[model samples]
Target: MKIFGHRGYALRYPENTLVSFQAAVDAGADGIETDVHLTRDGVLVLTHDEEISRVSSGHGLCKDMTYEELLALDFGSWKDPRFTGERIPTLDQLLDLLEDTSLILNLEVKMGFPYYPGIEEKLLEKIRARNFLSRIIFSSFNHYSVAKIKALEPAALVAPLYMEALYEPYHYAETFGAGAIHPQAGLVEKSIVDACHEKNIAVNLWTVNRTEDALKAQDLGVDAIITDCPLELITALRS
Candidate 1:
């Protein structure tokens, strides 16, 4: 199974920052997963929450803040003093950074809670320009967003994320032409994995940090495992 960094070895570095992503690459993660939000100035930025308060020194919805306004916030200090200078990175910046690597880019469109109109088009445009359609996986809690992505680009890969089990999820993926299903790590089971595999739908579990859990998912024959500590998981898997 492939191992992806959940927000870039998130346990050791600030999640979704450039340094964190570099750490993931240095630690030998196969890929790095990140969340995306469109700033008020129409710049796509990496961040998990709709609000900047959780990850940075700023207090406002990301959609309400311009990219310039967000640059002033200290995105890393909330996690550690040494990482105090880490700033939020635009998606363009991140793509430029990783364009040369073989690392898979899993972009979780942050459409839950607050929806951004035309974000699908914006994201699609950038990925197409970067010619990353083959390497990137677009995932979201909104199934409609997942559908939109597939509709936008026939060659684009999409995985719908779910916290709760859906009725016949493998079929759901097939109906939407999704390449994979991203379910919560705790929500995964051998039966679901089996069902998904039978339909040739890859199962990528999310937010798993424990070594035992990663091993279990591997034994279950899931396609990939997403974790906050890719460094530790990579070492554990190798050992």
Candidate 2:
């Protein structure tokens, strides 16, 4: 199974920062999973929440702040003194960093509350401009967004992320032309995996940091496991 670092080695470095993503690459992750939000200026930035106060020194909704306003806040200092100056990274910055690597990017479009208008089109436009559309997997809890992505680019690898257990999720994903399904790790069963595989859909579970959970995912024939500690999980799984 492919191992994807959740928010880039988030267990070690500040989540969604460039350092964390690079650390995930150095730790030998096959892919990187991150959240994306649009700034007030329409710049796509890598951050997990609409509110920046949790991860940075700034206090406010990310959508309310311009890219220039966000640059002034210390995104890394809250995590550690060593990462004090780590600024919030843009989608362009991340794509540039991953240009030479064969890592798939699971870009989760953050669009629930405080939604950004026309985010799907903007994101697709940026990826197409960068010529990086083939390596991205667009996912979101909003199934509409996933459908929008597939409609925008028929070849785009779109996945619907759901925390609740859906009845026959493979069918749900298929209805929207999704190639993959990202469900909470605890909600996955062997039957679900089998059903998904039978329909030629990939199953990628999230936040699987425990060894037992990782082992279970491997046994169930999952396509990928997203975890916060990639290095530790890689070592444990190999051993």
Candidate 3:
């Protein structure tokens, strides 16, 4: 299975930062995964939570802050003291940093409490702006977001993330017109993996941290594996 760094090699660096992303690439990840949210000014920024408190020195909702204000917050200190001044990165900055690399990108859109308004459009625009539509795949737990993207651009690769075991994943995949299905690793059974393949939909499992799980997925012929410790996972997979 293709090993993708979840939140840009989160274990080694501040999650979702450009530095972490580059670290994942340096460690030989096939791709990188990250979360995106729209600022009050409509610019797309790389982050994982609706609130900034947990990951950054800033407090309050990310949606409430302007891009400039969000940019001013220290995002790295919470992870480690050595990374004291790291700030949240813009989508453009990330793309620029990865411009010369051939690694694929998996951008996960977080499903906020009420869902961020116009976030779908803003995200699509950013991808188009970078001309990264082909290199990136959009993944989300929100079926509405996937449907909206499919409605606007049928060619876009939209993957719906599922956490619980479902009776008919293929039906749902077909319903969303998705290119793939990304289920939480534990929820994925061999049958589900086979079902997705039967429908020609790729299967990617999220947050896989154990070498045993990675090897299991690889043995099962899963298309991709999402993980936080990309360095370890890649090393283990290689060995």
Candidate 4:
């Protein structure tokens, strides 16, 4: 199974920051997963939460702040003194960093709640402009966003992310022509994996950090495991 860094080696570095993403590459991760939000100025920035206070020295919804306003916040200091002064990175910055690498980017689009209008178009436009469309796998908890992505770009690889168990998720995924299913680790089972594989749908589980869980996923024939500590998992799985 392939190993993807969840929010860019998030267990060791600040989540979704450029430094964390670079750390994932150094750790020999096959892919990096990140969350995307649009700033008030229409710039696509990498961050997990709709609220900025959780990850940075800033408050309020990320959609309310301009890119310039967000650039001033210390995104890494909250994680560690060593990471202090690390600023929030724009999607362009991340694309540039991954331009020459072979790492696959699983970009989770943050929508609904405090939604950014026209975010799907904006994200697709950026990726298309950079010619980075082929390297991305778009996923979201909101199935509408996933559908919108597939509708907008028929060639885009999209996946539906869900926390709760759904009846025959592979069928749900097939309805949208999704290339994969990103279910929380707890929701995965060997039967589900086999069923998905029968339909040629890849199953990528999330937050699988424990060694036993990773091994279980491997035995279940998962396509990939998205974990917080890429180095530790890579060592455990490869060793």
Candidate 5:
């Protein structure tokens, strides 16, 4: 199973910062996961929360501020003082940084109050321009967003992210035209893994932080596992 970095090693580095992403790659992550939201100026920036308070030095909703305004804030200090001046990075910046890294990127689209219109289409265009369609998987908690992407581009590799357990995950996959289902780690049972596998859909669990949890997911036959400490899991798996 491939190991993905959840929010770019949220534990050890500044979550969603380029430094964190590079750290994940350095730690042997097969892929990196990050969230994206369009700024008031329509630039796509990496961040998990709709508000900048948790991960950035800025205050207020991300969508309400222009990219230039967002850039002025320190996105790295909250995690540690050593990373104090690290600014929030644009999606374009990240793509440029990881161009030759051979790491698959999981870009999760985020939409909340004070929304920007046509974020899906905008994000798709950027990805296409970067020619990262093949290396990236588009996932969203809203199945409708996944459906919309599939409708726009039939070949898009859409994945539905679920927090609650489903009775039959394959059914959810089929309904959304999703090639994968990313569920909360605890919600993923053997049967859920089997159901997705039976339909040729991949099962990817999120936020798996420990060595034993990753191995447990691997033992259950998950296709991929997302973690904050890829090195720890990789070491355990190697042992």
Candidate 6:
């Protein structure tokens, strides 16, 4: 099974920060998963929360603020004082960080509050311009967004995220034109893995931090295991 870093090595560094992403790259994660949100000034930025307060030393909704204002906030200090100066990075910047590497990027489009109008189109435009579509897998909690991505570009790989148990999750994913199913790690069962694999739908379990759980998922024939502790898990798997 391939190992992917969830939110870019979230356990070692602040989630979604460039430092965390770089850490994942250095740690040899096979892929890097990140949350993407559009800024008020129409820029795509990497962050997990719609409200920046949870992850940054700032206040207010991310969509309500421009990229400049968001960039000014200390995104890393909340995690550690040593990382106090780290700032939020744009999607473009993050892509540059992975340049010349073969890491797959799982870009999760966040949806909840303060909707980013035309975000899918805008995001796609940039990806195509950068010739980044091949390495990206578009995922979202909102299945519509995943469908929209397919409608926009049928060739784009999509995986809809779900925390609850879906009846025949892989079949549902197939109906949505998805190439993979991103089930929460806790909800994953070997049966589910078998079902997905039977239909050629890859199973990439998410946010699995425990080594035991990671190995268990791998044993179940998972296509990839997304984890916050990629370094340790990769080491354990290798050992």
Measured on C-alpha atoms, candidate 1 has an lDDT of 0.91
Residue 227 of model 4 has an lDDT of 98
The Cα local distance difference test for each model comes to: 0.91, 0.94, 0.87, 0.94, 0.87, 0.90
TM-score of each: 0.97, 0.98, 0.96, 0.98, 0.97, 0.97
Pitting candidate 1 against candidate 4, the one with the higher TM-score is: 4
Worst 10 residues of 2 by lDDT: 184-193
What TM-score would you give candidate 1 relative to the actual structure? 0.97
Clashes of 3: 0
The alpha-carbon deviation from the true structure for residue 50 of candidate 2, after best TM-score superposition, in angstroms, is 0.4
RMSD (Cα, Å) of candidate 6?
A: 1.0
Of the candidates shown, which would achieve the greatest lDDT relative to the real structure?
A: 2
Model 4 error, position 142 (Å): 0.6
**Reference-based TM-score, model 3:** 0.96
**Model 1: per-residue Cα lDDT at residue 16:** 96
Q: Which ten residues in a row have the lowest lDDT in candidate 4?
A: 108-117
Can you write out model 4's per-residue Cα lDDT over 1-239, one digit (the tens) per residue? 99999999999999999899999999999999999999998999999999999989989898999999999999998999999999999899989999999889999999867887899999999999999999999999988998999999999999999999989999999998898999999897889999999998999999899999999999999999999999999999897
Better of 2 and 5 by TM-score: 2
Ranking by lDDT: 2, 4, 1, 6, 5, 3
Local lDDT at 77 for model 4 = 89
The better-scoring model by lDDT among 1 and 5 is 1
lDDT of 3 by residue, 46-161 (tens): 99988889999889887789989988889998888998889999889889977889888988887647468877787787778888888888888888887788788777999998
lDDT at position 13, candidate 1? 95
Clashing pairs in 3: none
Consecutive 10-residue window with the lowest summed lDDT within model 5: 108-117
Mark the regions of model 5 whose C-alpha exceeds 4 Å error after superposition.
Answer: none
Which portions of model 1 show Cα errors greater than 4 Å?
A: none
